[model samples]
Target: MTKYRPSKNSDGFTIIELLIVIAVAAVFGALTAGMLANATDIYSDSLERQKFISEVRSSFFKIIREATWQKSYTSFAGSNNKKLNIYSTDGKSIDYEIRNNNDIIQNNDQVSGSNNEILTDKIEYSSSNVYYLDQQGTGIDIVSQIENVRSLKLDFQFSNDTDDLRLQSHTLPYNLRIGRAMSYHE
Candidate 1:
């Protein structure tokens, strides 16, 4: 009968090796979980910022479009401060004031006789020429006093017909370009 000798090395992993492998796996799992959590947070923040910017832009354009269609009031005084004192539909009260300072103040007292409250502040514009609602419904923020503006541009389109040309002669631009560059952090 031939005698069989046992090998020095074990066929399977020892207890220590198994423990070490489990520890390494646990570490890797923890790191992966942390990275995933961080990524989720960043994505959520980006989405929120995007939504905020969209709301701001939408509100701004809506105001501009309305102002463009309405008749400008030239008889009112103290309205030349590169700010628009937009009155409510009732005509008895001011709704909000869009100022060249990039502030949107709501006149709470228009009908209630309350003072104006700032709805938004620190608005940054891309154009150096800040457009505000003048007292007369005119866009008159044409001075270079506005600082930190990244860009400013003006465009005018003329009518093709002679009758329309007369109307266009006295009219300001129907469209305005406003842009700004700034970083917003939340």
Candidate 2:
């Protein structure tokens, strides 16, 4: 009877084949890890943007509420000027001025002359923007350039035509959108 012998080559994968398999597995693992990392980064950025937007909206609404409740200035400038002179939140002062240009200037706290404090920057007028002020009256990270902003209407609801407000309605009739696109380059 012939001696039966098992071939070594048929027993399992060759060393080269094992190495190739390992390389493929390593590549797949790397890809998966990279994808996961990218997703995490995007999620984190979205959260931060949402927080910023919420804060901006809150500040704007607060200002509108105050305007509606106080209703200090019937006219912007005068009886025929179409402008109103309203006192600032701080009762001791009456230096806050709202102009026809939709710009608000809060004068500095002084017993005499009024120094302008621009609440919203020039770029923010056209765009639905948010402004952050530092302790030194410097603006930082003014996120303007909104996608679309047709109108930003602030209506003061009064109990009667006398401008004594019972409630206020702040409406963004058009798109009230805000976003930031970030690009990365090696």
TM per model?
0.47, 0.41
Please, what are the lDDT tens digits per residue for candidate 2 over residues 88-113?
33443333344546454555443556
lDDT of 1 by residue, 133-177 (tens): 333445444343222212222211112112111101122223222
Output candidate 2 Cα RMSD: 19.3
Worst 10 residues of 2 by lDDT: 74-83
**What TM-score does candidate 2 get on C-alpha atoms?**
0.41
Top candidate (lDDT): 1
Model 1 stretches with alpha carbons more than 4 Å out: 2-13, 73-78, 87-95, 98-102, 108-118, 122-186
Pairs that collide, model 2 = 75-83, 75-84, 76-83, 76-84, 77-83, 77-84
RMSD (Å) per prediction: 15.6, 19.3
Candidate 2 Cα deviation (angstroms), residue 74:
5.6
Error of 2 at 171 (Å): 8.5
